[model samples]
Target: MAPQTSETEQVVDLNSWLPITASRKAKWWYSAFHNVTAMVGAGVLGLPFALSQLGWIPGIVAILGSWLITFYTLWQLVELHEAVPGKRFDRYPELGEHAFGPKLGYWIVMPQQTCVQVASTIVYSVTGGKSLKNYSMVAFIASTIRGSHHHPATYGVRSHTTAGQIFDVLNGIGTIAFAYAGHSVVLEIQATIPSTQKNTSKKPMWKGCVVAYIIVALCYLAVSISGFWAFGNVFAMPVFDMLESCLVQKLHFTPGRALRFAGRSTYVAITGFIALCIPFFGGLLGFFGGLVFASTSYFTPCIIWLVLKKPNRWSFHWIASWISIIIGVLIAVLAPIGGIRQIIISAKTYKFFS
Candidate 1:
């Protein structure tokens, strides 16, 4: 029989598990750029639609609130790495294993992490494809207008009587939560920053996080706030869709003869062919944020912290942890249900090419 090892004696061999035998040496700036790109993508574009659903005040609060919660949870993961003496956790699932038994780590955290990754790839692909298609379509419209028509494609704001209600708030929360979905890579990025006397790896991680998230917040605010200002509630959840819809509505859905051929060949093949999954982008973001992000970002870290640290019950730390857990659970439960409901309600009017 194999001998048992104490927590302090547990050693993970990176070469045995990881494909890369050695960590790639990189400057903190490079790693910071990687983190920023990973975190900020198509999701930034959708923030305005979220703001449309959430009122301005609530939308601002949600962005700030989620950012703080996300940063705190990220820091918790860092602390978890230091939990076992003389050992460091390089991955989220590994930390889960360290905190709980292998079952929770492999079964819960791993799957959630995988789902988050796969969903993110889908969002990126759809966004990229649609972006390309929109560019081509706009070019086609411009040429057609110059040749056969006089008026340029123009769009106007469509307003709602109310900013939003409970369902809208939930949807906005889910979408905003999804915007901060790079937690899975935080530890790995932290590991690549070579430690120095004045600057430990944690220093770079903290610096990277602060810089990246500030960019994220500003980018998100610019899109959501400006979008709401321009389009109001008339925009689609996926902001790309909102933009395309603006042009389509202005063009009255029938492309000029010259535009139709190009639209049918390129636009249809690129955007329309992929749009069922694409328009669902916003809903998927909401679903993923609630189903995975809340659990991984909010609930898991707090639970792991309490479990490993064993903070005293009814104390300030304990009470705060419990509150976080409850909020995470509530968002997880409410957001998905509301998101799916919104998707279904909107599907009746959904069009592939429009």
Candidate 2:
């Protein structure tokens, strides 16, 4: 026998079908953090590649385009929030169904959303891995400097070393993983906000959106400015720019003892940094979880709901999702990792102002 829907389930389902919902004030900070994290991560991972492939002008253009896209998305969400104050944007599919008919609604949004999630997941995984390696290397260098009391002529920072290339690949994987990992928060947001709780106050949700955007923008600008200033012409990656600029090398103390001490210190520092990064890598794992959630929890359920409740027709959502997933997996498996990196750089150039 089919399981019966409880009152809570019924309420959740109803809420899930609405267009927008009021978010908690406390969650505003969380949203700000999320936006900042995403923007910085993207900039650090994307900027160097973009600059190398498309030149500086194109790279700047791409950044601008990405910003504009983000702005438009936020605007739409705010408008939807205003229209249906008690629901979330995820429920917009249902609203589309109500307005444009089920078939049209599913076709309009699901495929685009799925693609965005997939792209996001890949970027997160790749970038996260790179950040891990970059930070680890930084710790290693710092330790070495401290150990060698006989100040080395150079702090050993190089632009396009083999080590940098390896880190770049790792960063790409981390970016993908990070993008795919974290959906529990999104799920929690959907679950906790009641359908009946509308924002009756005229205080625009856009205020919160603007605050979140500004926080993110500042973080991006800081990292970008710091990176460019430090690396100048030699900056090969966003993380590299930050590292080159943010760290300072100093020489003090007796040579022999300092050398020994610095070596040990570097070792400890490098190890600790790597250890700390394991949790950040957890974000990549969360991205995989997000992919599963997007596929099974989101797209699948939506398809099933449409099939059962309204129309009984095969649709593009299923076809496009499967195709995209297949293509993504094939690309992940078959494409040379370097090739993928190049493609990402090229695509960023083509799509954005870059």
Give all TM-scores, in the order shown. 0.71, 0.43
Which candidate number maximizes lDDT? 1
For residues 1-354, could you state the per-residue lDDT of candidate 2 as single tens digits?
A: 999979776545433322223233334444445544444443243333323332344334534543443344344333433244454443434444544578986565445344434444444444454454442224334434544544333222223667445434433332222222222123222222323444432233344446656665554334433333334340012122112212312332232444544554554355445433332332332233233323422233333333434532356544543443443343233223433344454454343211
The sequence of per-residue lDDT tens digits that candidate 1 reaches over residues 29-132 is 75568667766766665676777677778788988888777777777776565566555565667778877888866566777776666566666666665564
**Runs in model 1 with CA error above 4 Å?**
1-24, 133-164, 195-200, 234-278, 314-316, 351-354
lDDT of 2 at 300: 37
Span of 10 residues, lowest total lDDT, candidate 2: 234-243
Model 1 quality (TM-score): 0.71
Given candidate 1, what's the lDDT at residue 99?
79
